[model samples]
Target: MSEAFCLELYKDKVVVSYYAEKFHGRKTANGERFNMYDMTCAHKTLPFNTIIRVTNYANGKSVDVRVNDRGPFVAGREVDLSKGAAVKLDMIKTGTAKVKIHIVKMGANTKQSAVSAAKAQKIPITPSKGTAAKSQSAKKLVLKSGQLYDIQLGSFSDENNAREYAKKISRAKFKNVALQKSGGNTRVSVIKVDGKDVPSVVKQLEAKGFGNAFVKERKK
Candidate 1:
């Protein structure tokens, strides 16, 4: 599925952002330590080790980056580049750019292969009964009112880190900065609004240095 998706995205223009220096040395989704100097990138669904050529539309500069992690997570964005790749494309100052992507090599880590490997080891693919019950309990908290959109700043595993980040955002004069715990992670969101205002809220958050800010829909 991802192989076909990659093929279809070839030569298509995509919005991309670069990782901040604070993320250097952190463990990536593939269990590799992220080095900002490496020629690597992240895509939400691309197989690990997939190599893709990204060309900046404005400057015509190109860099071949290996897919080593997952996310940009925000809507309207496709790839997240390392510092080296961003420097190569001359996008450090601008922070984000429109680029064209061409898959140079397809990776071996496909969904089907993973499922087959799990089946060979007799690993369970479905959730456990307890997990399903927990999910049901969580769903009971959902509001029955109309949907609301939240401009999320970030998510963290530590409650202290989440609170500190939320405070920082609040100090910046961004109103309604709040934290919510879900799925063992704490999420800091700026404000909730109607669906029609999501784009403007996202733009404001991005201008305030929250480039990865995305929308989260919830019943209100």
Candidate 2:
């Protein structure tokens, strides 16, 4: 899915507004044929054929349309709509309306346009408000104890070798060895530990060519 985007509002004049099918086959400002009946839309700089969702604030109704043509081209206007599109949102009579526009992803071109535009604008991509809370809760479990520790596991094919190595390590030994069998290989991992032991464990592991590892805290 394309990232959510904000509709940039122009100086209060229904800047990027819609036009309908009566202008079908008519020449758009950018020299493309305008087709009103198509579920398409227009924008000032958005590439043609880009699909956008137009939502009427007053009625809370929205219509998705493709950018088959170029724009309202009027000063301060950000988009232009076809007559049919305006009627669907019930904004035709006013000749202009306040609406929120968003891009809908149904294909690659629309996706690229939405992405390129979003990058150019430097918008922050954030999870939904509801999901954001869950993320914060998850992060809270990772405590900082102001100490360092070593965390590790063994993956040698021979069980004896794995045990001997574990015993040789000077740090306190954690016994849980999770042997995971994938295809013909068996891998071992140490999944739990005290927050204080993380740094020392990582340092030892790095000296042995086993790089730093992430810590996962147990949930109560």
Candidate 3:
């Protein structure tokens, strides 16, 4: 159930990136006015309002960020920190960091770490080809391959608009992210998973206020 999923905190080693300051004042997927100076983050699947600890490996710096937006539209990146987070991690120059993330708490519940650290699975975060390494702490969690129900996040008359939306959807943090260019529309790419996961995925998106999220059959 959604409530149960929210109660469990997820831990993962993911390639972390930052949101552009240009979107600082724009509306987030949760209908929030984004402020890049705040210590916030954008995650794909983590429940909105969740707080996480992000540790930057390059500088050995870490910071706590609240999940307020979604994305890192490109693959291999799991979390997108606001400028303030990037500054805390000293990642403003390289623009990316290999880091560890711990879900510190769920909304109104500060006890997630007490349970999550003991029970949360550490999913692998794929780094750039230059930085890829083996993870021995936990095995990866993946949906079984089958007839996956693909969801079209958006279709835009302008290419930039589509790409922008795709980036936001990427914050959902699923590895099988995709994009297709046809004439003008760009949508969040599809993933191949058993049809059963569709409802759950949609529900998570809905919980975050993405009411238009839906699933459709993939084209062969």
Candidate 4:
């Protein structure tokens, strides 16, 4: 499999939904009879039988599920869980939830399955040579500098206030939001960004009512 394909599988900010009675007993993409009561899930490109831990971001409830089918089929949604798995995460009432996915083990069909699924979805199989070269150059530049940028959302003297604000930011669907504590201050910030992207990220936060957001640079 191409490096680009492998990297895409690990990208974050996954939103998931569940399917239950409607799909139960149907033949899945992997040729198995769907069982809504079983701990199985459908992913766009994960290989059949791959195991993953799905954690609900809001409540911290998590469940281990095996990939047995393909897709949530909707744009902006990543994985589709079985009713059983969704129940385990206490997300049945919401129908859809923001979650974190951690790969537990890769399945045997990793290469073949991912490639075929990507093709079906009309996604590029590999990056163009120029794109790949540019990406490598960018990585080298970051490594050499050992510097990173953050968009600070807020800083509070109280830890509880900082955590509550962080949760509020997360519920707004912002990516990479986190809380950091140092001394008596707790800061809520978005921790993933290139220096050049700081302005745009700050603009996004401002639009969502975080008008005090500012950029901070840190050396690794």
Candidate whose TM-score is highest: 3
TM-scores, all models, native as reference: 0.49, 0.43, 0.53, 0.49
Task: Tell me, by lDDT, which candidate is best.
Answer: 1
* TM-score, cand. 2: 0.43
Query: What is the per-residue lDDT of model 4 for residues 163-195, given as tens digits with 9 covering 90 to 100?
Result: 766787788788898888876667788996665
Clashing residue pairs in candidate 4 (N, C-alpha, C atoms within 3 angstroms): none
CA RMSD (A), model 2:
21.6
The candidate with the higher TM-score, 3 or 4, is 3
lDDT of each: 0.66, 0.49, 0.60, 0.65
1-220 in candidate 3: lDDT tens per residue? Answer: 6332344335445688898669989877555788999999886545568878887767778788997765645656678899988999999999999887765677552343435333432222233322221122233322333655565544443455456756655676644656766553345644664555655565555454333333455656
lDDT (tens digit, per residue) of candidate 1 on 1-220: 5343444245457789999689899877676889999999986445678888888999988888998876665556778999999999999999999998877676785533322222221111122222111111123122112446566666655566567667766776778889988887677887666555455555566555454444455655
Model 3 quality (TM-score): 0.53
lDDT of 2 by residue, 106-214 (tens): 3344444454453332112123322111111124223345422223333343344344434443234444445444454333445454455554554554454333133
Q: Tell me how many residue pairs clash in candidate 4.
A: 0
What is candidate 4's TM-score against the reference?
A: 0.49
